[model samples]
Target: MSGLRVIPTWRHGREWLYVCGEDGGTVAWYDREADRVSLLDEARGGDALEALRPFLVGSVAVGPPPVPTPAELAGLALHPDDDLAPNRPGEHLAVALDRDPGPPRRLRADPRRRALAAQQRVGEVLDGLEAAGWRVLHAVPLPGGTYVHHLVIGPGGLYALHTVPARGRRVRVADPFVTIGRAEPQPLLRRARADASRCSYALTAEVHPALVLVTPSSAVPPAPHLFTDTTLPTLARTGGHLKPADVEALHMLARDRGTWTRA
Candidate 1:
């Protein structure tokens, strides 16, 4: 019961509740209004309210993960004009929270909810990369309530990757911008670059900027103009520039709490 937690999540932009064990186990997804829970195996066959009653009675965060709080976000001097400024849709809520610095904002339309798919995609890719001798980290917290989704250290080189969820859609990347279906090109390369700089300083190593676009239905192949294609296999195969010791050093730095939380 101590490890039980309920955090806000979404399935395709719709409110979907997520429950998991802090000690690590299969995550359970719920839909309170629908009265259902989604199994890890993609099957749907459980009573959400019934299964979650015990946990919910005494514990539920109902917001973003605990790593970065609103007060924490406020401490960082992330001015509006700063490159690391919360400019995109993803950064707004955290920045807003910083100004107000109160209890976790209500669950309605949490911006972090939108990054769930990207996190899952990045997690899958990083899992494979870890299995294949790559050192990786995910959901790395930084100042200003922002998070570094994925960081890879291996022979290919150190990479700070930002995930773009473009699944089941045609994605075309044309430098500083990416077009997904009819949507306008949302430029996130700068975000990735800023993340890399932060990682570089944290690990005291040069980090490369990269973007992973999760597209299962892209008719066009990845090109340099699109930035490096960051599929699971692509990430697992490339970036072999770090040695074992170097990788260890980076892992050590990444795990060090001061590397990120410090101003």
Candidate 2:
């Protein structure tokens, strides 16, 4: 007996069974979805097969793992400190709040909190689009201390989304101007378009601009690009703009902090 054991693990919603030696080192891993077995230690192939026999539903191609793609290679080459992939929704705001929480009691709520809530609400919906071949990067910092709230790339193409906090308030849009409730109109759409333009310059690709309204009471004059939290998932249904590889490549580029310095 080779004294090998099989351990099951899950990554990105996919199941894998790993064959380990007595020393607790992984010898091989079987990906049932891909119907492949990747051998970490070629010499232990036989032991790995034996250990994985029970979990093997059928025949699987046995070999080393596939080579990383260019996008993946770039990602792997990035230093941890320079990588933005680990950033959460409203990462900049979250950090600021951590550093300076502001007054404990306030007559009015901090606008940053409202903005963060909007970003997080939209981010949750965007994250769900990954199942449909979409990738989303949140809180992408740009030059001059400005940042993109969310950058989405997928078969539908690239979008720079700016979240608007309009909870229970009516929103009216007229090109560059956006009016929320009784507050004065703001050139939010213009800002969104500018953000997309900056992203396009940074990545050398066209990036559509869109405003995401969070739980709005009602939005006036339906716009083609404007999206509400409920309708944001429809982006996954739109396709033919780019291939899967393109989406991944763009995502890889967008997740690097240095990539936005040019913007």
Top TM-score model:
2
- Residue by residue across 1-263, what tens digits does model 2's lDDT show? 89988766532335677676766666788999999998878988988888888888877899987886898567645554666776778999999999999999999999999999999999889878878988888889999999899998899889999999998999888778989999999999899999999999999999999999999997545676699999898898999999988988888888888999999
Estimate the overall C-alpha local distance difference test score of candidate 2: 0.85
User: What is candidate 1's TM-score against the reference?
Assistant: 0.54
RMSD of each: 13.7, 6.9
Q: What C-alpha lDDT do the candidate models reach, one value each?
A: 0.56, 0.85
- For model 1, residues 1-263, the per-residue Cα lDDT tens digits are 24545555322223555554554343465555455554542331233334466544343333222353333233222222221211222344345546765556565544344455456656555656655556666656788977776776776778777877665777776666777778888777778888889888877788888777766465555643133235446655665477765665566456444667652
The candidate that achieves the highest lDDT relative to the unseen native structure: 2
